[model samples]
Target chain A: MASNTQDAAHGAAESAPGMPQLDFSTFGNQIFWLAIALVAIYLILSRVALPRIAAVLAERQGTITNDLAAAEDLKAKAVEAEDAYNKALADARAEAQRIAAETRAEIQVGLDEAIAKADEQIAAKAAESEKAIGEIKAGALESVKVVAADTAEALVTALGGKADAKAVAAAVADRMKG
Target chain B: MEGDIAQLGQFIGAGLAAIGSGAAAIGVGHVAGNFLAGALRNPSAAAGQTATLFIGIAFAEALGIFSFLVALLLMFAV
Candidate 1:
């Protein structure tokens, strides 16, 4: 075994000088080119593209915020308008109620005055009727006295006794008085 | 002269790799910062655009990784 190992070692050393070694010499060049590419890409992004994009985004945000604020303001105004409309409606209702109450009072006063006037007119008509009835009664009484005296004179003539008109009238008045 | 040239080449290669990495990092930071700022502004768009942002970052990172690989190859393989 030892003699075989010695022979193998001698043969390997003879072959070693003739065999080519694996080469890895171009890695530096590859790295240098890659580095140059990386630096160039970085410079383009940082210097050329990012700032414009950022500015556009900022402008968009500003517009959104402004729109939101305007919407909020409009909402507030709408609420205020609603409140004002309600208040105005209430005020108008109150004014209408007030006017209605005043009109009712005026109507009531007019009705009361008209009723009072009618009552006065009725009282006056009743008094005039009473006066006319009194005058009629007086006239009827005078006619009744005249009829009674004529009846007495006719009755005396039928009996063939003369009746003095003035005496008969005085006797009838005295009888009625008694 | 040969020794001086080798030293200069090594120095230049290392410097370029370092500069590449540094520049890549700054670029990645800018991309990430802008992405975050945009996401904050429009959260709804963030999810939809996140994949694209990541892709851009990966591309930029690949450049740096490639530079590192080249440096390693120069030192060890070449």
Candidate 2:
């Protein structure tokens, strides 16, 4: 194994090229190329891509924040609108109740006046009827007295006796007293 | 026949170096897997950690690339 390795080593040493990465001869060139590549990439990213991405990110953040604030404002406005609506509803209800009470009072006043007027009319009609009845009774009594005097005088004349008018009147007056 | 031993050793060394690539791949997988686990656990925080996830992945992948470069050097330049 040692002989074989020595022979392999001798063969490899005969050739000039070995691990090219380790070759000091090309290090300067590799470093120069690497520097150029790094600078080019840095310039492209800094000048173009990075700034645009940053601007876009900043704009997106701003938009999100503004949207949140707008939503909050709208929420507050909604609450305010609800409160106003409630207040208006309460006011309308109260006004409606007041109007209803006022109308009820008006109706009550009108009803009371109507009843009083009807009672006064009824009482007046009753009094007038009572006066008329009393007059009719007085007229009937006077007629009955005159009729009795005539009937008594006619009976006495038919019987062939004198019938004094004053006497007949006195007798009728006594019967009426009973 | 005389130089075959040296060539064999170089091939063997390149093969060994290539194993590092698989190890690096495992490291990259670990980074991605952990990031996914964390992201799934707290999805709300996932968006903010995306840059960190990518940085982890890039570092793991860079190691794998370095291993591959070493394998290539062993095979061709050594």
Candidate 3:
């Protein structure tokens, strides 16, 4: 059997003119196997692997879109928050300004009232002082007149002249009138 | 022998065809490297450009596969 196989192999090597792949006898087998493998691969890819890959790709795309949408939503929320914060800050400033203005107005009113009250007290005190000065002056004038009459009567009697009380009183009265 | 010389020629031709496949590999590398560089620079646009990158790779790989086919044809068919 080995010798026969060797002879057959030797005959094949002598008869074959070119590469084995070009041999017409094996062409059908090679072509058949190649077609089968190619078709099988095509079927597996189209029916199974490709659809799975496409599903994964779609899922990835959906995830990316969702993430982008979420990011956009977050950004809008942040912008709204910033706007609200700014509005609140502005409102707080306005309120503070209003309070400051109100406080300033109240202080101004109180200052004006205090100044008016002080002025009224000063005017009353000045009037009271003026009336006291007028009374002191009138009392001083009456005492001076009485002392002058008594001095004139004493002088007339000491001079050894006719010292009549009625006459001295009349003379002192006329001098005091002038 | 003439047959021995022909077989040597076929092998040598196949080896030479392999060089073309190697050159196609360099082209594929260039395409892929450039795509990676561009993608890294603009990550936000990377998704939009991924299909184009894959197409470029496939075209470059097709040339390599053609060279491989030529090598196989040289070694076996012709």
Candidate 4:
């Protein structure tokens, strides 16, 4: 078995001087080229590509924070607006109530003034009517006294009795008094 | 006859080295597929993970290149 392996190794070594890449003379060149390529790739990625990516990430973060802050500001503004509206509504209600009370007081004063004027007019009319009634009653009583004196004098003369006018008038005045 | 046997041995060794290259291909595929899956799930974080994905690809591809080199060496070198 050992002889067979040796034969195989010898034959393979003799065949075409083996792989050119495996040649010791070219190893240094291959290693140098590989190192150059790796370094170039590393430098390009770390310095250029990686920094740009980092910048984009930072920019996106800034935009998100700004948007959130703006939203918070808008929320605060909305709350303030609601509070202002509520205050205005309350003020309007109070003003309306004040106007209503003022209007009610003015109306009540006008009604009282009107009622007092009407009562004064009615009292003046009643006093004038009572004075007229008293004057009519006095005139009627004087007419009745004169009519009774004339009737008594006429009755005595028709009976052919002597009726003095002065005596008859005095008797009528005394009877009226009784 | 000895020369023929040696050539046959070299060819067989080269073929065996090709298996290593194929395994490296599977490793690269795994790395890339996992990165894509993660990237799709969180697009905002995708950029952050890209460097790691490239590094994984580079390591896997290096293994494949080494395997190819080994295959070449087996076929031609002692």
Candidate 5:
């Protein structure tokens, strides 16, 4: 087995090959150095550089997200303020309308009371005048009846007839009724 | 005469290997040019792709270095 392996390697080990890279004698040395360099680079990058970069990127992302959330919060507050202002304005308008309505109602009540008092005075005055006219007519009729009774008694005596006071009153009252 | 022919062949192979360096330079330029075009189209995304751009440049440059090493080996060691 050893002789067969030596024979297979004879072309590479007989002398220096056309290229140093193809020389089997240096292959292990080159591979060892390459592996060492690769391991060193990997250790430096993974242990020190990559973690720091990742942390910085994460922090930046967090800052951006916080700023966006703050902006959204401020916008919501602004909308709330606008809604409050509109509600206050509507309430003020409603209050003003209610006040105007109350004032109108109060004025109307006062005017109605004043008009009713005036109408009552006018009605009372009319009733007083009618009562006075009725009293005056009654007094005039009484005076006329007295005068008529006296005139009839005088005419009966002047005609040479016996004048009866009671009869003369009865005749005057009956003629007045007609 | 045999040594002379081998030396001639090595010189020719070394000259041919040098052409790979130029090809690698073209590949690097193509990668960089496409990256610039994309970056110009969307400047906002340019910063994020910078690492990728560097990786592509390094890979293309490595090929050029490899070709240069091959040419040197042919000229000196072979």
Candidate 6:
């Protein structure tokens, strides 16, 4: 049985010519090193590097989200501020218009009052001038009557040497009547 | 010994090529998935970035295809 096993092994070795014997010991060593390398790589990635990288990435994502939310809030606030500004501007415009209208009305009233006062003053001055003219005309007419009566009495006195005083007076009255 | 060494070399090369192709495919898939997600989120930006995405995929696929070609050459032509 031992001889048979030896012959079988030799035949198997001879079948693949120029093939070296399998080095199981070397294969084992290669496998052990490969395993060590793989484990080291895994440990470095999982325990040392990957955790730190993950933490950094997570922090970056958190910062990004917070910035986006803050931007949205700022946008809302800007819209609110813009709305308030527009409302205030519109209110100011309305107030200005109202004031303008009131000022215009006041100006119109003042102008009307001034015009009425001027008309009253003109009417009073015209009435006073007419009254003054009437008084001057009456005084001039009375002075002319006195001057004419005195001249007629002097002429009658010069022409009535033989006439009585009562007759002369009666003649003057008759002439004045004629 | 020479024949055994040659066979081992072939096996290692084939394994490396296979692993390289698999990794390239996974990397390409990840890039594609992210591109699609970004495109869906912003369709307007998708049009501008489409050419770049395709270029990146082509480059990765070229590497994977080259590895396959090398494996085929080693297996058949060699």
- The digit string of per-residue lDDT tens for model 5 on B8-72 reads 67567888999999999999999999999999999999999999999999999898989888887
lDDT of 1 by residue, B1-78 (tens): 123355456546866776777778988888899999999999998999989899989988888887876665443333
The digit string of per-residue lDDT tens for model 2 on B1-78 reads: 354666777868888989988998899899999999999999999999999988998998898898888877665566
Q: Could you estimate the TM-score for every candidate?
A: 0.42, 0.51, 0.47, 0.38, 0.37, 0.42
How displaced is residue A26 in candidate 3, in Å?
Answer: 3.7
Error in Å for residue B18 of model 3: 14
Locate the minimum summed-lDDT window of 10 residues in model 3 chain A.
A1-10
Model 1 scores a TM of 0.42
Error of 3 at A111 (Å): 1.2
**Ranking by DockQ, best first?**
2, 4, 3, 5, 6, 1
The true-versus-predicted C-alpha distance at residue B71 of model 5, in Å, is 5.2
Candidate 2 versus the native: TM-score? 0.51
Give Cα distance to truth, residue A36, candidate 1, Å. Answer: 4.6
Shift in Å, residue A146, candidate 4: 15
lDDT of 4 by residue, A7-84 (tens): 646655675546664567777999999999999999999999999999999999999999999999999999999999
lDDT of 3 by residue, A1-178 (tens): 5455345345556757335645788889898999999999999999999999999999999999999999999999999999999999999999999999999999999999999999899888888888787788777766666676567667776786666777766776687678
Higher-ranked by DockQ: 5 or 6 = 5
Q: State the lDDT of candidate 1 residue by residue for A62-178, as single tens digits.
A: 999999999999999999999999999999999999999999999999999999999999999988999998899888877877888888889888899999999889877787678
lDDT of 2 by residue, A15-119 (tens): 444555566788899999999999999999999999999999999999999999999999999999999999999999999999999999999999989988888
Query: Clashing residue pairs, candidate 5?
Result: A18-B78
DockQ for the candidate 1 complex?
0.03
Native-contact fraction for each model?
Answer: 0.00, 0.33, 0.17, 0.44, 0.22, 0.00
Which has the better lDDT: candidate 3, or candidate 6? 3
Model 2 per-residue lDDT at A28: 97
What's the TM-score of chain B for every model shown? Answer: 0.78, 0.89, 0.90, 0.89, 0.89, 0.75
Better of 3 and 5 by lDDT: 5
lDDT score for residue A113 of model 6: 95
